[model samples]
Target: MLLKFSRNGRTTKALSCLLSEGFKRNARPQQAANLLRPSYLLFSPDISFLRRPSLLVKRVVCWLSVNYQISSNSWSDPMDTNEASSCLVEQLAVDPERQSSSPACPNDGDEKESVFKGLGILDRFLAVWIFLAMAIGIILANFVPNAGPALQEGTFVRVSVPIAVGLLLMMYPVLCKVQYETLHRLLRTRRLWIQIAFSILLNWIISPFFMLALAWAFLPDEPELRQGLILVGIARCIAMVLIWTGLADGDGDYCAILVAVNSLLQMVLFAPLGVFFIQVISGDSVSFEYAMAAKSVAVFLGIPLGAAILTRFTVRGLASERWYDQVFLKWIGPWSLIGLLFTILVLFASQGRQVVHQIVSVVRVAAPLIVYFIIIFFATLFICYRLGFGYKLATTQSFTAASNNFELAIAAAIATFGANSDQALAATVGPLIEVPALLGLVYAVKLVAKRLGWKD
Candidate 1:
């Protein structure tokens, strides 16, 4: 059944069931009274509705958000969660608004604040806690200089041990945030591979040459500085990329795929790229792949991800989501910060003596990283817009492609070249700049969308 009405000679249709039997029936008289008042307030369009995407995208996003997103608010709390879920499910079941056409959907504007509107620049900056940890890692490694490797050649627990611990701490809230099944669904997304292409092209095909040129332009004589740019350019920063994408109101399902694929690809290809880059720029090619492969297993390619998967299985259905949020995420967010601080202290203990020597080098590397980031940022933004993608998708594409995979980069860098290698230093610095830079980019994307009057 349908209720058809005409306004200004244009006709609109609403589901008859909604008008006859649900929330509207209870409030029909009250709603009619407001319509009779003839005041514009009763009829004003929701400005937010302008920014929302086509009905189809919203439906898919709503489904994913309901079933998978980690709830972070009072409305999602235990006291009313079942009822909320039921209501959302009911609205979705009807799908009163078809995606292809503009219609007034019952599901629209129900939340007090859209999640995208809730996040600000500072939160995105905080997402880069790992990047800050990495910077401290470099400072400690360069100046303090630990007693040489006890376990393997060039290993820096003497410097990096604390950084690793801080990284583990940093992973807590993040791990808590992850939903493995949600990630799986995202993997099935057809858009995932396309977005991956954007990132790979940006990081490997485009960014490297830019860095190579920048290194020649500014630090032409220094092979160390040149090597650093190559290392940083090759590896991508996985965790932080998702954080920015989420902040930009991008589809979380797509962002999840970005995380998993980048993690795997970095292990397989990052070493080869690092060697090629170092050989190309520094003209001193060593056996870069064999050693880098080992570090990949120890750091991200193998252990941490495997551990995350195992933890998911062990905890499956052990407790309600409400309990998990209250007990787990609440605890992990703060502890992750502690893990970061402690890791900095340990890294300082190992690498602090050399920190003074690396000061100039960090400054040198920042110039190219910043330029490459800005160029890619707007470039992706332009292409995504031209392709007619929504702000959410465009923003995600821009950031995912713009940022580096620092974890893989740093691991590959150290494995291929000692922590002191200018190349290794470059990878460490990518996150430091990327964290703050992406925050600024997030704000820029939001503001630009607002200015262009782009929506849907």
Candidate 2:
């Protein structure tokens, strides 16, 4: 019953008969005809189809006839079989709609929604989750004493196997999010240099001096605790700040530059900074080895960073860049939170008994660290505002400046001092105070940005 009109003539005759049949079946002829709007049709005529015109026409006619019968099958109105056949034959003469009904491209909304949905409730209340992790770790340490030692068995330089793995996992996803191309472009931008200078001034000069002073003020009698706090201050953050920066809707590209710069600077300056600060704060000649500092940088920052770069390059080369960012990285993003939670649990579990016994000393040590985070966050924000940077860059600078790389500090403390040393204990208390405080700062930044009408 399919119509195969010749290219020579009868094409218009056949189409008119199809429209007449449609007008008879549909209650509103205009509305039914809208489905076959010829103006909206997208077609590309192939040379082969042109050469085999009868074959092409006949095939299209058959396809249209089948589709028409399927579409009209549920209708209650009855028509003669011959009349229905004539209508379908006529309808086949109309041009086919070549475009797909489905969307041609994926949307950003879908990607973001998928990622956020994947996170679930734990991600939304991350600070509460960390607090719960601390409690669980403490409980494990107190009751299941053997578990802590067993978990700590694969320890290297006082850093437990689980903690090391967690640190790497926590860092990799954030590092992978950094676009090297954006970093390269940022190098040429004046704002990048401004943020760099700002970070260096605070991280190397101002913050170290401030932390040394705080340790002296809070733990004047506890020389070991003072030394550890100072070490924590000297080891500027390169990894965890990315999480805080993202939370504050900060400029990620600029943050990545600062992170990279800080990582390299830590290798050269960390030992000197630790030695100098501990000497000044504790009034004792503190031993700090350059090899230890370099090893920390290599393990904590270098390994994860190298892996991130390799993964990014391989994924981008193998697939589309859009797929890598929107799909692959989106899934990888949650590993950061998982690593953080696991690391916290292990830290508290190992140190839980010790933390309970020396809770007073931990609190005293934490006082200065908490104050340092607050003062440094505001100080950096004020500086950025004075520099006329937007909220995005300002928050990025604040987070980079305020956060410390506690992983490096913990590793250094355990390597130089014993695992059971007060120095290690003080380093362990850092994230307990730091995580909650930074989450508050993130909220504050958002509020301030909205009040000032700053663009994210």
Candidate 3:
């Protein structure tokens, strides 16, 4: 007997087959609201912690708040023997070049990995992989011809089935890595408010306008491309900013606050801001259902966030928070990278024909994006410097503002427009430009830190 299941009024032979190939569902906003009603609040990154605080925890929380300042010096204490040992073990897991430069520390057999140990070969060479994926996708689209068309069938909410699955894979692990429990202690600091205000100014006020200007200035003839860029600007980075912020040796605690705030804000502001900006710039009436945008956020951002929170709670309950973070999460975190690469492959393959046909246009779209990253980085850096923030916080702010949530943008584009629309094409181009460009910025930050003697 053949096993089959029904979803969105369609029957499939097997869930796993659809999962591997691709599946689509036309989830509407009301449906999303109903589906997420019980756990909608869980979408906020502030809602869950790996472990609940005990009587002993209250004291620790109080002590931390009383002593903690937003400055790097306040948080960057001298590593204890165990921490240093863990750092050394983490160093040994990477390249020989990185290993030779590793700092000295005690060797404890059970030493845990550094929080930043999650950045491995895959992350470092992400741009190269993305470029190769794009090429392979284009090749497949040319030879197979049906490859792209095949994935487009049975679409729901305008998102391709393969793209939907790939997105879920890319996001869940990133959320799992966040230490949401630390966010409460972080909220107590005046420095956090300063960072929050500064982040808001950049993400909402500055970044959106900046992207709008660039897209309009560069793509006068291509309204779809312009709209796509504007859509990207409105949705701030929620997930992968953690990776960039972590790799740059920024304050993880502060970054968590920024991520949480942006996640909440995206739900409220993304659709309005997107519609407002796109209409103003295009001078063309744009029709976008807020519900569709909300649905996309609910499925892509909300679902992964909920899963991560529950997973953290369960794992920490079974073992300790330390094991969850260091051992289990360390193993689980790479799935994000795997998911990212797979998503890239599927994303490019689906759009390969269009990208090849519009190669020059793609390059033109990328030009403004490259400029946007550079300008935002330095602009944010200058503002952070003027605000008297230290290097770690400054860099975190810079990165958070500079990176866009391309996944969210892509999902919204497909949901609002269609998978094959120019908007989706523009959204897909974002990660392509960002991966290598942002990686370069990471090294620049490290070198600057070394020269300034601002230790992480």
Candidate 4:
């Protein structure tokens, strides 16, 4: 009704009442009023979330999980802690009471879940498993050396199995962590390419010669010793370099790009370089066919990598840093180490006797690898100071060059010459000294960095 009031104040009061009546009949008015309502009046975020059509389904599902978990009898049941932890995973992170009634959604519980997973994976001992596997391989090589005969006819698993698996481990986890967007963003910096070029030069060009030189000093005219040193050089470092650089605060984006590029390039060139190094250093004929076969088998690297890519899609939003932390990193984190341990157990079962038999060979190979580390580590620092590469980048480049891809070398050794080969045995020793030695360097670099008035 169109109504007029006698007083100005009374007219305003009448219009307010009339508008309130109209709001009760209209959805637009009702929604607007809901927004205008005070915090104490309603849950604001809930309303906003409700308006987001895409999130509606997830919210509903999360809502159900939260309610069910909060009310379920399952939570009270007795079981081993591991079993209980697995069960908790099913409880989607959606706390109703904790949910803000505000327009923005609270994603705390979701984030917590992901962090739980990611950290679990990171905390694992995948390398330990691999290390133990090497020890096992040595034992088998010495003990049940007969098994090597069964695969003597040469099949993919014989050649490619370990290489492929190691490659997969080497490749996949790194790929899983890689964000194409990050790489695209990282490409803007010419410094990253500079670091990469520097890393590659040290890794391929200079590192091999140094290893050869060290081997020459320690073991000239010793084919076994020289060949072993060459393998270490050809493989180069994939893991430990990142660790040292990470400690030194090298740019992670640049480091990541470097790892990806290095891994790919190494795969392509390792065989040829390995062949060349053996020929030049040993002046002996080696098997190109056998090396190719080993490379063929080395394709096992695709597994974890394939799984990682699939997982990104299957578990959708968890790739984001927040969700990754909240959801997946912890549980899968340890699988690599676990896988490595299991692999070691198998290798020990398979190659235990061989390693024991060739204990002397293992000892002999260490001289060069150790010397390689010392030389590169110091040289990198010197170069950094001279070229003004800074401690962070220099330290990173040094460590990457300092470490060798032992897993690849070991697998290639086994694939090419058979599991019981002395060269393969030498390759396995790489990780034995690498992890501990590199850690020591990390501390040492920091100490030296402090002395130099560098704040890393």
Candidate 5:
């Protein structure tokens, strides 16, 4: 007897056939239902299956055979009982190969895979690429000698043209990936405000003071380096934090919101905070250009953000959301890594000689920074995790809290203290140390999440 079962007004042919064939074979209802339990648990949204396992089995089994059309011959009476059961099992089995190939229907294994699995080779070995880029930049600076000067000659708004281009390229793709549509809902949520408040406390209140203490503890005699470290601490991250958050598989929408908030706060507070930490607190006389910090935020953040908004809305408007997500995003995604590497090359090349020659100074500066980054990242991560923020938001909060606005710090240092000053050198060392340090944190965060059972 042919039976018909419908879910949400749609008939399920495969499920009907399975149940009819099972009953014809005189199979127990429980046994027939058992075959579909795994599929049901994996895919079905309905909890009714939990209470009425046998009753809902037919509806739940439909998805298994929906993708592949089962021929009538397979279900013909000419087939033996064993043959029929085998045929049903074969048709209903979830094929791993097909599941991986088809992006439309993702399985549990896909969800469990490493977040970094989707990234390209360049993104996977990001630390290695960054080191190689830094090495090449150093070699160019030392051997070619003129290459650094040539690359550094042109400046747009006091940022090297090469560096500016790399920053824009790196940041644009990342910003484009932000879920702008969800921002309104995110803004409306009280959790977002709580997170923002936590960020402000950690980044503005705790982190700067912590770095100042580290700077003093590590570099007591080196006043210039201490001043630079304090500046780094107070500036707060607006740029590379997004890249780090993305690499760590953090929530890009939340990271973007934090970044925007930090940028605005940095404009208002960076100069005063710098003065407070360096001069008032550390007893170092230094002039910090408020305009320099504002301009750095505008150029580094504003330009790429505006471009990303235009690109995202324009492409999404012209094409379907699926096309934009699956096609345009895939095409532009790799450029973020490319830009990161390029920026590293240009940045290190500009200051390569100093990095090489002033190894002692670099070490002195790096010691405190390394300590500060590790402590702040783990502390913030732990706090957020305890607060039940989940892996994505916790990782985002940690990176944003731990990272500094190196571009702004370096620009302010140079504009205030001159290009060749020790303060500028210290500011430059911030990224040199930060790149590898934060890259390490990315891996650490993933491992910790796995250990803590933090599901994505």
Candidate 6:
């Protein structure tokens, strides 16, 4: 018989009373052992054991060994039913007291406390740092004009050199945290395939068209801004989505896989999609350099991913897995945030002049972008939630859908239109809007998850 444990004081007391009566009638330890079987012990839903099944088994074994004075080696020893009944009854009489005193299992509160308090001060206040970085970047850009030019001076594959470095630093640690060895298992699952199909549908088909409609509706008179918005729509995110996913406590492995797929697709689809959306649909002739887009993908994603893989394998080879996970990961983890802040500073500084001079235009452009982000993010989040994709994967799907590859967008705009053109300015505005918007969504996702009881 499967006996379930509910989180109710009366039910627990009744169960204890029933167990006492059964023990008085000389119930065997074998029956007690069967009751404690990992498969049979149906705990309250809120317990930590529900999240970690192995932990459940370990705790059960530990409880039996400690409370019943059973040796681990003799756990399988068969006792004569008649001889062991009195001892079993005595042990069973105090079973409730033993369980209440046992420290073998963690409760829901302990689990939540550990998970929530694990983050350091930097992680806890990430939004404040990002906002401060933006303000500092703009101040530096306006006060020190040379800073912008110097930061933008050298370009590696159409990305500014400093930005390239920042992207690598930002992505490397996050990618390293992904369990790449487990990716094959995820790839074999139907759920992952479903997620990929949904991502492709939302990102390529639905999102681009939605942004086009919004662009037209909002900026009817501004052709350059409209074209820029369309370009932003076509270039799906490959970078920084990982950071947002990590911040939101989403599935990093799955997010990395989606980012990889998007990068590959961006190289193939971006140029043609740009032509179709901008030239054909909007009647604006814009030349998209396919090579530039390809180069940007290679620089932004390829380098960091390759480095992360190498680092992961090499460290695992030299040291133990525990050392790599506990020591090495902690060492390198903070750099991702450092890289993020530096990237934000440089990004806003580079575009600060345009942001200041064209404050009114930035606001107008920002309105639709903000709407697009919030709409796409929450819509995808709810759809994934209702589809039963749980919180982690659902958050991954939402952020991936909402984020735009602004690097690709900016490079494409500049190569197609002049650097000083409205299209370039609009493209530059993508990060300005996306940074805070998505950061806010990270917090919003947590709140929604809590209120709805969404589990990992």
lDDT of 1 by residue, 1-456 (tens): 123233334322322222322223222222222222212111223223245445344444443443332223233232234443443333333332441122223333322123343233434345455456555655655554443232123334222554565666555445555677666665677776677787667656776667667777877777866776766666665666655775576665566556566666776776777667667546776666654553553454235556655665565568665556445554445564465445544544344444446778777788888888899889989988998878777887788778776655666666667767776666666666776787778777877886787677
Off by over 4 Å in 1: 1-159, 182-189, 280-282, 312-316, 325-327, 334-359, 453-456
Against the true structure, whose lDDT is highest? 5
TM-score of each: 0.63, 0.73, 0.71, 0.60, 0.78, 0.77
lDDT of 3 by residue, 1-456 (tens): 111233334332221121222111111222222221212112212222234334234333422321221112221242133432332222222233332222221122212123223246776666677678767877887778899989777555557778778778877887787777777787798878978988999999999999999998899999988888888888798767777776677877688778878887888899888768877656867777777666666777788988988998899999987668557876877788677777778777778888888888789889999999999997887777776778889999999999998877887887778777988889888987887788778877776665555543
Clashing pairs in 6: none
RMSD of each: 11.6, 14.9, 19.2, 16.3, 10.7, 10.6
Worst 10 residues of 1 by lDDT: 35-44
In lDDT terms, how accurate is model 2? 0.74
Estimate the lDDT of model 1: 0.56
Task: Report lDDT (CA) for all predictions.
Answer: 0.56, 0.74, 0.68, 0.55, 0.78, 0.77
- TM-score order of candidates, best first? 5, 6, 2, 3, 1, 4
Give the higher-lDDT candidate: 4 or 5.
Answer: 5
Worst 10 residues of 6 by lDDT: 1-10
lDDT of 5 by residue, 14-116 (tens): 4454445444333334334333444533443334445656635544354344322232323333323343333333333334244223333244344435646
30: Cα error in model 5, Å = 36
Clashes of 4: 65
What lDDT is reached at residue 413 by model 6? 85
Q: Global CA lDDT of candidate 6, please?
A: 0.77
How many residue pairs clash in each candidate at the backbone level? 25, 0, 1, 65, 0, 0
Report the CA-based lDDT of candidate 3 relative to the real structure.
0.68
